[model samples]
Every structure is written in structure tokens, then in C-alpha cells.
Target: MEKQNISVGLDIGTTKIVAMIGRKNEYGKVEILGVGKSKSLGVHRGVVNNITQTIQSIQQAVQEAEVTASEKIEDVTVGIAGQHIRSLQHSDYITRANSELVIDEDDIDQLINQVHKLVMLPGEEIIHVLPQEFKVDGQAEIKEPIGMYGGRLEANFHVVVGQVSSIRNIGRCVKSSGLELEGITLEPLASANAVLSQEEKEAGVALIDIGGGTTDLAVFKDGIIRHTAVIPFGGNVITEDIKEGCSIIEKQAELLKIKFGSAWPGENKDNEIVSIPGLRGRDPKEITLKNLSKIIHARVVEIIEQVYVEIKNYGHEEQKKKLIGGIVLTGGGSQLKHLKQLVEYITGMDTRIGYPNEHLAGDSDDDIASPLYATAVGLVMDGLKRQDRKAREAQEELQLEEESYDDTESVEEEQVLESEPKERKSFLDKLTERVKDFLDNAE
Candidate 1:
């Protein structure tokens, strides 16, 4: 199989590092060949703070995936998220020299490239430039401007930005692990792709990915991403609360949160309690479930409120910004008991747990379908889409080359009949120069 046909997704998250190997199956669904996970020791809130530990974790995950899939891994599409990630809206346009010429993909590409050149704050760089809408000569809200005649083309872009050092740290870890970076995608967007359906995007929806150290939000309307934000708190904070409130170790706190915590405090009975083995040799300490739920409920409410504030900032009061499809929660933290219910109650919108099974083959492992793997699975999907696009572009280039060759033959006959050798050489030289320039600018 071609190298492009196989893709790997590396999710260097706060709680764990996941390496997933996947390829498009015959049915056009992702066939997950193998998945490997390792405890992430160096990453905090999605940023690599310790290069050595992060590289070791990545290697371990990739080695396990290789063993399971029986395929060596090299290139991987990675996911990025943290408090440092931010997004904003900007409008840009370009004037065409020939107004009579219909706008094409090249025009759109040029417009996007212009937006990429916008000056950012010091130490910041644009991660994604998503075109929200387009306008041609003041005609607004054009979903696609291709094949339309226009003198001035404008577009509103949702640009995601991040800290340069944070991104470089991730790159360093990937390089030190002996892996090539295929691509880097925002974690929220990746999770959204893995869990959201076309209908949901069309109807408007909000995706909340509650990972170990950060909660990511991605809002979509009219099939376009409108907003993205990263909250600094997540499941790890709740675990910290548990540790402080219950006076327990980090491992025990995490275990308690996962096994017995609930977002709704009222659901837990006062009489229900669990005992934790005391450290060293002391008597076991009993903790009431209701109290534990109360602690979790407090933290969960804060996170939900922060996320809802972002949702409101998207102009939710306006009819166009209303999310009829409501909120879909994913990631490891979304598994907290009654989280969906809590989100619905607080935000007053429909809510559901999002599993990353939408694009997976039916025969895929159950573990791969969990919300925790959403970002990794979506990264693989992005890789496959990119590969398909490259293949299509290559095919079109080949066809264009054949057509140009045929045209050249006819032109050569005309030149021979006219005996214009100088004109032919000049034309051929110009064409060769143009081809070189085009190839140089292709990427």
C-alpha cells in the first residue's frame, strides 16, 4: 500500500499519550489497526513542559502501536490544545486584475494566504485559517465563490492562534521520538470531526471536549466553525479538588473521581460511603458519596459555566446563532456521571455524550470508539482526507499536463509551417519558466 494510504494519529494529551494507526477501509470507514496508550508525565494542560519525558512517552505509545499493528510508524498527525490556544475573526479581500475572469480555487487560495500574513502578537502564530463566508464585489454570504465573476473577493476567516514556543516544544518532542510530523490540528476541531455529523453542523451545534487538563469548545453553525476556546481547567482539577477535600493521594483521588464521582450532588445518597485504605498502617477512612459528589458538582458547575459563557459569546441570543443540535460532550472528563444532564440543565440546551465511532468501521475495537480517543481518531480522518485531496490534485495535474502536451504538438506544427523558430523558442522558454514558478508555489 502507498504510504499516504496509511495514517497515524498521535494525541499527546494531558493524562495520556495515544498513538493510533488507521487506514481507510473498503467501505470508506476508518479501520483502526492498532491503538497504544502511555501515561503522559511531561505534558501539562496539553503543552510539553519536559522534553525528555514527553519524548519517552511518545516512543512508548508508538512502539506499542507498532507491535499491535505489526507496522512501523513514522509520520503522524498530532493534536494541539491548551490554555494558550485562542481564536478571532478577521475579514480580508483581494482585487483581481481581470474582473471578467471567473473566480476559481486559486482566487480563494490567494485570499486565504493573504489572511495568513496578518500580523499577530509577539510569540503568537496562526494555527488554522477557516473561511467562514465569502463575498464577491460586495455580494455577501457566498458559500462558494468559484465559477463566479468578480473584481473584488472578500472572506471572513475564523483564525486559531497559539503560542510559538508551545508549538515548537511539541515539534521537538515529535522529532526526538524519531517521528515525522505529518500535520498538527487543534484538539477541539479534531474531536468535533470525530463525533459530529453533517446534519448537526448544518443545524448548529457546540462541541465541548473535556480532557484531563483543558476543556475545549468548538461551535458550529451553518456547517462552519464559528468559535473555539480552551478553558484551563478539566478533569485534573476535579481530581485535585478530590485530593484536597478528601486528603488522599493523587492516584486515589483520580480513582475516586472516575469510579464514584457524579456531577449532580443530589443524586448521591447521604448514607452511601466508600472507605479508602489508609496509608502506611492507619485505619481505613470512610468518605460519604454525597460529599464527594458535592465537591465534584462544584467544580463541574464552574467548568460548565465557563463553557456556557463562551457559547453565549457566540451570539446565542440571535436566531442565527441558536444551536438547535445543542451540545455534544466528548473526551475523558465527559464520562463523569450525569455530566450530560448537568450540561443540559445549566446551558438549557440539548446534550449528549459524543463517542468517536461515527467514522470507524463496524469491526473496530470498542475501546477505539470511546470519547477519550476522539481527537486521535479524528486526526487519522484528517490525514486520510488530506491524502485523498493530494491524490485528486495529482490526477488533475497529470490531465492538465497531457492536455498541454497535445496543445504544444498542434502549436509546433503551426510554428513549423510558419517557420517561426524564434517565436517557438521564446514561447517554450516562457512556458518552462511559468511551470517552474507554479511548482515552487504549489505547497
Candidate 2:
């Protein structure tokens, strides 16, 4: 029996590292095989700060996933994000020597490669070169330029850049954990793939992934990504605020926020309070739910406002750039109570929590389908897609080779006929003669 293709997604996040293993079922939905998570101690704000701890966390998560799935894991598609990640738009063009030649994939690849050669600030490297739109010989907005006759080809690209040192640290961790880095994808892009629908993207939408250390925003219009931004603040900052505001331990603060925190202070009553047990026989401390909400609300608002400013910068007020699909929020931070309402109110845009269940099998674990796993799920989806593409390309190459061999065989047969002029036996005649000779020899 042949083994099914499986893909692993490793999300090295700020507060936690997650490893997910999955494969597409016959019905075209992701069937999760296993999931593993561990508290992150080495990463902060999406960048790996402590290599040793990050490697340990990765190994732990990968081991758990391997145990649950009953398979050996070797490679992973990792998600990368941080304050060091930034994107810029640039227009570039290539002049062709032959004016009458039709544009081909090679031509497009050359153009993209040219963009990769562009110089950047020291220590910064381009991570993604996403082509927005193409122009052929001064003709504008050509989505597919192949087979079009043009002397000059041009395109606008959204290039994502990140610090080299930060990227290398992640690679080192993955290598030290004994796993190959199959690919690296932007976290927000992965989240969007897991949650956003085609119709939403085509109609213009914004995907906000509020992870532990970063709030990533991706804006899409007319099915093309228009903008991407990573805000340094995330759920961790909110927890920090709660810890300071309430004078509680970090662990206790995290528990309190998950259990009682709300982004909308108005939703909580002033009289509602939760008591935290004191350490070492000290008196228990009281925390009002209303006050907790206020603390959360302040940080959440700041994060939202920073993200909203990016949306505005995208010229959302302009009719062409308006995001009709509004905003879809994902990631663990999005699980907070009343966050959707708060975002809607603040941005004046329709909002909803993004769950990864859209592409999951019906029987997938409920926990894996939550918004928190969107990035991991999306990474697996991306890996599967890449596997399929490679399979298709391999098949095409095989077919081409077979066709070439057949042509060569036909030419050989013709040459033989021309040289000897002997009548060749039909396939059936040859087989019958061989069988008769064998029988006669046996008798």
C-alpha cells in the first residue's frame, strides 16, 4: 500500500508553539491527524529571541504530534512574523529582445527574479514577492500575460521583507529540533487562507490575526492582496496589562484574562468581581470584572486603532478600495469575549470571528477548528497545495518524456523498414508463434 501524503505545520508563536499534522481526505477536507502545543519561552513578538528554549519547545510540540499521529515527522512548513516583517510595493519592468514573441512562464519568472535581485536595507531580506498585476507593452491590468505578444512586461509587486538575523534564528531552531524547514509563509496569509472565503476576498475584505505577540492585518480587494501589516502588540500585552493593573502573577493573570476578560467594558457589571487566592497564606485579592474589562479594553482599543490606521492608509474610504467583506478576525487573541463587537464598533466595519473549520473534515476535533489554530491549519493547507502542484508537474514531465520516447521508437521502426523491407509480424502473430514454439519444444 502507498502512504498518503501528509503535511506538518509548525507555528512558532509568541506565547505558544503549535505543531499540526494533517492530510486532505478523499472528500477534499483537511483530516487532522494530530496536534501538539507547548508554552513558548524563547520567542517574543513573533521573533525567536532564545534559540535554545525555542528549539526545546519545537521538539516537544513535534514529539507530541508524532505520538498522536503515530508517524515520524521529518519536515514542516513554518509561519514567520514579527515587528521586523514589513512590506512595500514597487513597480518593475523587463524589456524583451524579440518584440513579436509571446510572453511565457519563463518570462514572468525572469521578471520576478529581477525583483528578487533588488537591493534592500542592510540586514533586511525579501521573504515574498507577490505580483499584484501585470502590464504588457503598456497595456494595463493583465492578470495573465502568458501567450500575449509584447516587447515590454511590467508588474507591481508586494514584497514582504524581514530581518535576516531573526529569520536565521527560526531556521536554527527548526534545524536543531531535527526537522527540515520545507517552507516559510507569512502568518496572516496562512490565517487568511484558513478562514477567508473566495467570495469575501473577491469582494474585498480584511483579515486580522491577533496572535500572542503580534496583530497581523491583511487586506484583500478584487481577490488580490492589497496590503499587509504586522503590529507588535498582541494578546500577551493585554495579559501583561491585566497582570500589572490587578497586581497578579503572570500565570494567574493569563488565567483571569481567559476566564473573565472582556474587550467591551460596558458588557460587564460594576458589581461583578472575581477573587484570586493569595500566595503563602496572604489574604485573597479581589478583582472587579468591570475593572478587568476596562484594563483589557484599553489595550485592545490601542491595538485595534493601530490596525485600523493601516486599513485607512489602504484608502478604504475610496470606493475602489472599500472592503465590502469587512473584517474577519482570527488567532487566539480573537477568542476574547466581545472582541468582535469591539472591533466592529471601533473600525465601523462588519466583523466576525474566523474559525478554521471551513476546510476541516466534519469529524475534526473542535479544538483544532478554533480560530486559535487558523495559522497552523492554513500552513498545512498550503503544504498540501504545494505537494499537489509538484505532483502535477511531475506527471506532466513524465508524459512529455513518454511522448518523446514514442517518437524516437517510431523513427527507429521506420529506419528498419527502409533498410531491410521485411514484413513485421503483428503483435498477436508474434505472441502466437512464440507460444507454439514453446509447446513444440515441450513435446
Candidate 3:
């Protein structure tokens, strides 16, 4: 099969590594072909800690996905997020030599390239430089600048930055696993793509992707990304709190959290108790469900408040920047019971759990449509989109060549009008043409 028709999304998270293979169906929906997941052992807080272990995990996931889909995996689009990720706002302008010339895509590309040259903290590099609004000449707040006449072009940028070393580590791992790295996308943005619709982005919205070791925040307004942040706390922290508070093992705590954990402590009754078997032959321990919820509630609230602070920093409190679409939560941590209610109560905004099914085919598996696979789904979409863009670009190049050829053909036609272009013109033919043209003009 042609490689262009297939796309693979590799999600390397702190809790698990997922490999998803898919293709775009005729209806523009993504048809998931196969998915493979494995426990992540060498990653912490979304960053690679052990190269060998991470590579092995990636290979295992990819191999499983390959077997299921009956296709070889050669390249993949990957998601990246960690505490080291950060974003900032910046403004820049470029002066054009001629105001009479209308602004074009090239001009915008030039301005973006200029912003890319901005100095970063020693080890930090820019990941994405998204333009917010544009100003042509002195006119401001223009969303589309093309075809507008302007001497000076200026715009505000939302620049995402991350540690270069951490980025390199991920690249090395993918390469060492014998796979080509197709692209690296921010996890929050990927999750947003899978869950948030175009209408939501246009009306403004905030996406919170709660992974195993980190929580990612992405805010969109006026159909443009305005702000982004990464918090170090995630599901793992909540599990740690549960284990410590209940004096139980980590595995049991995780199972309990999945089975009975609630973000709202009020939902649990005081008499409800969960018994945990002790180590070796020791007596089992009894813990009240209410107490268990309290631990989760505290950690969940802290994480939500931190994300809220980021929203506030983006000026969401202002009428113009208010997120009418509110918040969409996804990723592995979003599955907690009553978590949506807790978020809505704390932030006072409408909240919904984001499922990756938004762009998937109607018959996609229920398990694959869950919020846990949102990042992987989005990455696959990204890969397919890139493929379309490349094909379109190639077509444009082909058309340009055809147009140029037509221009030359038109020249030959004009020459034919003066004489016979089908026949080679010798010295005698040129002299006869000159004599005939001179005789005709003289008459």
C-alpha cells in the first residue's frame, strides 16, 4: 500500500505509550485501523527519563499496532508536553519597501521568520509561533492580511517554548527505535484538535488535557490560540496522595481511584468504607470512602485552580475574551467520576468531557473514542492533514510548470502568425520575409 494513505500517531505519555494507525475516510472522518497501548516505564512528567526503556516501550507499542493493522510502521507524528513547556506573548513588525504592493503570504512568512530569530533562554527553543492579530500600515486587528496594501506589517504572537535538551531526548528516542519522526505537536493542542469543534474555537474555548504526569492548558479566542501552559501535577499526583492517605499500595490506590474516586467529597457518604488487603499476612485496612474522596478533592481542586489562574491571565474574565465554549477536558485523567461537575463548580463555567470521537468514523470502537486516546487521534489527523497539504503543493507546482509551458507555446503561435513556425527558418526564408514585409509596407 502507498505510505501516503496511512498515518500513525504515537503518544508517549507518562502513564502509557499508545500507537494509533488510521486513515481519512471519504466522509472526511478518520477511520481508526488499529491501536496499541503499553505501560510507560521510563517517562516522568511527560519527559523521557530512560532512553533505552522508552525506546523499548515505543517499539512494543508500534509493533503491536503493526501486527493488528497488518502494515509496517515507518514514521509517526508524536505529541510532546511536560513541565518544561511554556508560552509567552510577543509583538513584532516588518517594514515593507513598497506600500503600493499588496501583502501576500510571502510577506507574512518573512515576519514569522523574523520572530523565530528572537533570542531564547540558553536551553529553551520556540516550538510554535502563532500569529494572533495583524496590523497593516497603522490599521489594527486584522485577521487576514493578504491582498491588503501596507508598508508596515505588525502582529502579536503566542510563542510556545520548551527546553531544547528535553526535545532532543524525545527525538533521539524515536530515532533509536528505528522510526522516523514525522512531527512533534503539543499535547494540549492535539487534544484540542480531537475534541474542540471549529465553532467552539471561533466562539472561544479553553482545553485542559490532564495526562498522567502533567496537565496541559490551551486557550483559543477568535479562532486563534491565545495562551498555553503546562502544570506539573496530574493523575499520578492524585494517586500518590491516595496511596499515602490510605496507607495502601500504589496499585491498589490506582484501582480504588478508578473504581470509586470522586472529585467531589460531598458525593461520598461517611459510612462507606473500602477495605485494602495488607502486605504479607497483615490485617486488612479499612478506609472511609469520604476520606478517600477528600484526598482526591484536595489535589483535583489545586490542579483546577492553577489552570483557572492561567485562564484568568489570558483575560478570560474580560467580556471580549470570555470563553463562550467554556472548557473541554480530555486525556487519561479526565475519566474521574464527577470530575466535570467539580470543574464547573470551581471555575463557574460550563464543562464537558472531551472524547476523541469528534473526528472519528461513526463505527469507531468505543474504547478508542475515549478521552484517553484524544492525543493519539489528533496526531493521526495532523499527519493526514500534512499529507493533503503536500499533495496540494505538488499539484500547484505541476500547474505552474504547465502555465509556463503555455506561455512558451503562445510565443510560438505569434511567430507562426508572421511565418510558418512548423518549418525551420533558414537564411533565405528570413531574407524573403523581410523583403516581402518591406514591399507590402512600401505599397
Q: What lDDT score is found at residue 19 in candidate 2? A: 97
Question: How many Å off is the CA of 187 in candidate 3?
Answer: 1.4
lDDT measured at residue 163 in model 3 versus the true structure, 0 to 100:
84
Task: Identify the candidate with maximal TM-score.
Answer: 3
Give the number of colliding residue pairs in candidate 2: 0
Q: Please say which candidate is ahead in TM-score: 2 or 3.
A: 3
Native-structure RMSD, model 2: 12.9
Error of 1 at 179 (Å): 0.8
Candidate 2 per-residue lDDT, tens place, 1-443, comes to 12348999999999899999999999999999999999999999999989999999999999999999997889788888899988889899999989777887678778888998889999987777778899998999898787799999999998888886787677778877888776667788889999999999999999999999999999998888888999999999999999999999999999999999999999888899899999889999999999999999999999999999999988899997899999999999999999999999998999999999999999999999999999999999987876776676566556555656677877566544443422222222232233334434544
Whole-model lDDT values for every prediction? 0.87, 0.87, 0.87
Which residue pairs in candidate 1 collide? none
Candidate 3 local lDDT, 131-227, one digit each (tens): 8999987899899888899899999999888886786677778777888777667878888999999999999999999999999999998788899
Instruction: Give lDDT for model 2.
Output: 0.87
Clashes of each: 0, 0, 0
